[model samples]
Target chain A: MATLEDLSKAVINGNVAKAKKLTQELVDAGVAPLDIINQGLIAGMNVVGVRFKNGEMFVPEVMVAAKAMSQGIEMVKPLIAETDMPSEGKVLLGTVKGDLHDIGKNLVGIMLESRGFTVIDIGIDKSPEDFVNAIKEHQPDIMGMSALLTTTMLHMKDTIELMKEEGLGHVKAIVGGAPISQDFADEVGADGYAPDAASAVDLCKSLLSK
Target chain B: METFNTTRSNFTRASFEVNQTIFWQMLSDDQCEEIFMTVQELLERTGVEILNEEAREIFEKAGCWVDGTRVRIPSPLTEWAARTAPSRVTLCDRNGKRALRVETTYSYFGPGQGNSFVLDPHTGERRKPVKDDVAATAVVCDALKNIDFVLSNGYPTDVKEAAADLHVFEALVANTTKPIIQYIPSVKHAQAILDMAVAVAGSLRELQKNPFFVYLIDADGTLVHSDETLAKVIFAAKNGIPFIYHTKLVLGETAPVTPAGTLVVALADVLVGVLLSQLVRQGTPVIAGGIFTVRDEENNMLPWGAPEVSLVGTGMSNLLRYLRIPSFGFAGASDSKISDAQMGLEEAFSMLHMGLSGTNLIQGCGLLESGLTGSLVMLVIGDEIIGMIRKIIKGIEVNEERLARGVIDAVQPGGTYLGEEHTLKYFRKEFWWPTLMNRNRIKDWTEAGSKSLGQRATEKTQSILQTHQPEKLSDDVLAKLREIIEKAEAAL
Candidate 1:
């Protein structure tokens, strides 16, 4: 029987196949699903987060580890009750309209998911209506918009305004990108602003806590 | 030149012939070849997007595949263009005298251009820069011994936007006699700036022969060149002005996320400008380099202080050296908002790394806040840093005299060498003296008001501004420069 420690090590090493196999072994051994998630997968990702913050690991390495942890999470997710599942929060992410840049948004999604948030990425060049409809569909705890161009960043304000018109103002909104700053975020009436992906995760957590 | 020969005479045959100097390489011969081959494949397969119709026509005439704006250059054309581009470019001062030689492993340090804000030397507040800031920057750069060339450190917002490049050039030419690298927005500005340079050089032919200033033309990244950029490239080539075919690659946005992938894209982007220049005029002098920045994944900003910048920048320099093109790159820049410890740390490391790599034109001397702000204090600090880097990159010489066998024998049994004549003969050349750095004892430092590096640098900058008198342009040249600026303003 595979111990939870072995599963955690597999996820930390980013050995996706071994992580999946060990997760299966734990499931066959009748380990609890919540225990497998908290001890095996999140435990490994927690180490990755620390290592990344301490500069011992880089973005790609953390990304690979997150992939491994997510794969293991997928295996045991069906066995758990909806209320019993571990989730920090739900976040909807997209690049603003007329902007095709998505690398930053995708990285934020990966970081949020690794921290146990349910992330729904709406993809690139999303119009204001697209953001409102996605927020209505996902009913996420936070909405994150990204834009790489100065021209396209204006749509972030439009998206927030449309959200207010659609009576979705209770859902906190966050803005980020190369051109997005805290002053612009405040001007756009966003709930918060993050400079990069790591801070985006923190911004979401802080907004949710508030 | 006589002094150089005299200094070299001390090296014995064995020491002179052997490669004993310390050097740094980011890529080996095989790695350079692999990257070069990958760049060629990328250029042929993916090609570049040339937005100018004339540039597209030129590519088509050169037997490249031109589909609308997408131009695919063959490997042979790139190889041929690399061969035709001059390996050495000499930049002259305002007097049309050769001052800087851009070839081989020789590196020259200078400030950057296009900063929007200036750190007020007196008030220490960030504000929009005016035309006087450009002249002040030039004056400081002229007085600094290590800064080999001058670039307008701040973009003058007070001038007309269309002819701001001309005004900045006028200010630089008026204040400093050092060689300048000009930043122009369009071909019109390029022509006007060239007119002002010609006024100083006395004629276009005389200007081209000694080419005091270089035009900076940038390629929009992701293998794209805009219409205005290509026009300036063509203009500079046709007029026989040296220009840096440069671009700034932001990882994961305008370029690939990985360093090697970014290198491929960077080389392809710069080569588009290079090939276009050579297609316009054979033997056109072009320097190839770009400000390589990694997008800080945490901040979502293209950070100037990242170590990856040095790594990728040195790699690009090595590639340019491999292709036998003069290289330009960024160093002595910081992301910090002030001249703090972080600024010093970042600037020192990047300057040391690029200096050791021997990049031809290492820019970014006075830049702060990731190139958004310019600080004269930072320029003074960078001058000191470059002086130290020059000593480090010179490496140690091994000779019968430098090994000091006779001196050691004479100073045996723990005798003091501080009083020896041998120490007196070599101490000045062997040591790098700091102008702004503090080396006083703690008591003496406190007695001297306990100034920090930033305070000392500020004092040095103010002193330079007050005391240093740069060589002025002649009255005839001044009147012609004024007429050209007036015409440019009227046109605008």
Candidate 2:
């Protein structure tokens, strides 16, 4: 009796166990793995995303809903092949060197995850070396650097330079923060800039499509 | 139809100009009445010192305890003052047109008067402000939409120290047609400034109906007033000059440590001012005004933006509401040395707090470094903040047109309403669009060059300075004003 709509509601309510159980039931009922992943899990997260953008939903609620979506995805993962997992893209995310501010960066990561992008958060105060290593190891489609301070944001340019020198030109550069702006992004040779979390997901998707 | 009244055949037609103010008070009606009662008791029991012979005679004639300059006013006299003072006060612009209709708690915001220094936009240094600085400040205020009136920001160090006020007054009067609330140091200076204003008005009778400036006088601290303070009151009352009688109470220093004790002292100070002004002439337009702030014991400094100041403002507003007089409080000010993050946070809190506390006229805009310096950049950004607060005060409407029930139904179940007719009908009015604050996409912002909010504010100030020109005083009027000042200099 557990339907895909029930799974979507569970994800929207941020009920991880209910979401996973309903997703498993949908899998057992022979619903296509891609259909449950899109029509159920991502469908629920899309509502949360829109609500957050409209200022109706807040970050804690978005984080909780994202957790439920991640759990639901885990339940439907085994039925789908690795190459056909339906991820929009992989993004390596971090707060750039000398900047410990990560609340915005974490919100951006969760938003990307909810939008079907795999977000690998290397945490705050990341060095250019750490970013380069992560780019080589993860081979992420996008590299995100955030800095909330003026002194630390200079490292954004350094990390972008490392990416360029390493010949990882396919990995697009993205930057944002309290003091960061589109002009700063262009000056540092970043591919895109996002002022806030919801827009960060959109920025990654648009950049990946190109 | 049945007859509605016995004396009159039909009920009178009801008509009134719409007063769009979101009225709010932090105290209840009973509590507000209690503050007035406390003020009366303090006046009747603990006598106030009236430092002028004429002022003391008026108090004594109204049954106050007179011992030298110390006079204890009776409760009846204080009540008489509240009853006699005009319930409505109007502010007229330089063109003799009514601008601010002040009788209720409809908040109007403007910068402060007589800042000794101004922040130079070009050099980014705090320097002594001159006459040009006053004109520049007035022009910026004229350009700002939220700034309803002008006040002399610069003390004009270039002018003679004995006549700095006149220079400031002339500079402000020259630059903006907006009504001003500023000071004249003495009774003689008040007359000279009025003469200048009258010259600009083309006649004495025209100046009477359209006094473009309001007088501000200090009641000092508890139970003490200077002679000139009372003299200004008499001049303003007899001449029909609108005035605000105010005091600055510093808790644990000039007043008691507790807010209640300080409130009582402040209330008595303003009441005595009102009583004196009313005694001079009935129906005198007067505002019951005071600023109450406690020193930060930990830091040993006056926290102008402290929450305690807002509390005092709220309590005083409640008292004035019950007394049926206008309220004035401080807002859009900061303790920070610069217009940085701290300035933004503090000013936003103060402006919104005082705006919601039912003040009719709010001051202290563009003030920073604890009211020591005035910055045009901060004044411009303060406009953006007040505009945002205005949107908050507008709130959300839940009626049929605002609710957009049909639009919601149409967009239900994963439908977007971005292209809907309802959206077009309401978005511009409902949403508060920022004029200076950036909301551009990162690529565009980076393309435009990453600018901070401070930089943006500075740029706006620069642009206004370059483009915005104010109405000028006529050549003959200027000559007449200078002549009046010359006469005052020869006499005083």
Candidate 3:
């Protein structure tokens, strides 16, 4: 079986091929896919993410590690799917109506998913009804909205009001975008505010625990 | 109706009769007190300018340095220093309105985003800005009151029609009660705009009255010589408009590694522009311009902000202020962070120091993500911050009236000041209520659906666009502007 150091280096160095090969070797050697995934790929990615947070690694390094993690995910997605893989929580996410910009929302989704949240992304320009429908259908623990344009971020308030009027206010709401703030979230009756993608994940996790 | 001149207006268009003393000035009572306090605090506590040996020496000799962060200069010398600084400038466009009393100490400029240039849904490739774009851009310039002047977004594309573009910008800008820094490129184009400005002002006296303007160096902060500089100098001298020398310094991939070396190189380029400006327009204001950005290890321009940039920005601002020349620097900007955190932190920190250091033009208002993009929401946020800083600059009033002597007398018995006539008279004037910043209770906020600042600003922007239609032009003026644009486009 490949040592943790080998797997660690492969992930940190962003060597997707090496990581895949190492995973196969571990699997062939009778090591469980769970161990390889949990202690190897995920653990390695955790390290990469930490490094990125501390500024020890920049965007390119983080990107490379993300690539390696994705390759490993591709190998294990079916296996994990078959076994009802553990997740942090369920989140319903979408950009508010009239707002098409998605970079901020996409970042939040990726970061949440990376943290093991089963994210049901409702896509951009989703109206309040769309969010309510998704929440009812999915029964998500939390609903998140994103908007980038000042013009469209207004829709977040409308969505929140609509959600309340339509009996969906019981679902915890989180809002983020270029212009959204703690004050704005509070103003819109959102349960919490996440300033960035990383913060959103942490906030989601905290909300779940509560 | 009250006479226009009697009104307490921010729009003050006045000039000095050479050698006439306006002794009501010096540092102005408020400026002197603040500077003295700042200097004393800086000198007593921190030994100001210890890093720069030359500045340190100067400080030690002229200031009573108590510490690195504080220094005290005598009031008379402080007044002399303040008097040497350039105060008001005017930014004029073609259609009769020119933003006057525009503080040239600091200003900002940047373009809108790439994909969102055209508002029309059906436009193919962001149709090259026609007359409508010019008119819209002019309104935008007016709305962006923090921007001291105008910069060319796409090249104006016409040497002869430069006058008309200037007219559109000036007409729209007439709404703003601030100065206009005319951004010109080629010499011929510069001449065209200047001629138009002169024609619009109606006389040399009107131009002289608001003579504080800029024939800005359009060399892209590089050393490349261009004919625009020559035209600018000639027009500035002939019409008495000031000149702002600009140089942009990009570090990491563009320049040296060390921040100091980058600053020196940038300063040298600025000095070249300054000298050229002075050579062309004697006694005109020559300002230091350009932004310092960097490329990180990934070569992605690394979020566009560096601490070194701020430090250098402050240092250069102080340097120019001391040298008796006006300067400009990036004030309200951020790297890649797009949220309120980015806006709050970047806008306050960047502009605060520049304003404190007394840089003449601190641009970068309403800009975000390292000046790569802009948001109307961000601009409103910056404006609120500017209001706060203006309060800071105004400082506290410790006079008897402010001390509430009469109110104390009347309320000697247990009573409230809130119900007093004095309170009623002054409360509104004293408070700076932000348009979008909600300070209401959570219940009230939620009842209103807790709209974000962006949401509120969007509504405000729409309302302004819809209701506050600016003063319109006559058919004759419209036809003239169109003819000018048509000829220019045809040639292009």
Model 2: per-residue lDDT, tens digit, B1-492?
011111332454477444354556777888777877888888878778889888998888878889988888888888888878777688888999988877766778899865778899766799999889888988998889988887877688987778878888888888888988878788888888888887888886787787778887767777798888888888888887788898899988899888777878888888888888888877778987888888888888887777788788777777887788887788887889897999998888988988776687888888888788888898998999889878777655654455565666665755544434455445557778789989986766878889999998998898998999888888988888788777776777
In candidate 3, position B158 carries an lDDT of: 30
Query: What TM-scores does chain A show, candidate by candidate in order?
Result: 0.93, 0.91, 0.87
Estimate the lDDT of model 3.
Answer: 0.57
The C-alpha stretches of model 1 lying farther than 4 A from their native spots are: A1-210, B1-17
B-chain TM-score of model 1: 0.96
For model 2, state the Cα shift of residue B241 in Å: 0.5
> Which pairs of residues collide in candidate 2?
A182-B442, A182-B446, A183-B445, A183-B446
**lDDT of prediction 2:** 0.82
Residue A149 in model 2: shift from native, Å? 26
DockQ of every candidate structure: 0.00, 0.02, 0.01
In model 1, the Cα lDDT at residue B430 comes to 84
Of models 2 and 3, which has the larger TM-score?
2
Q: How many residue pairs clash in each candidate?
A: 2, 4, 42
User: Which digits, one per residue and each the tens of the lDDT, describe model 1 over residues B39-157?
Assistant: 88888998988899998999999999988888898999988887788999999998989998899888899998878898988778999999999999999999999999999888889
Worst 10 residues of 3 chain B by lDDT: B18-27
The number of the candidate with the highest TM-score is: 2
Ranking by lDDT: 1, 2, 3
Better of 1 and 2 by TM-score: 2
lDDT of each: 0.86, 0.82, 0.57
Look at candidate 2 and tell me the lDDT of residue B198. 78
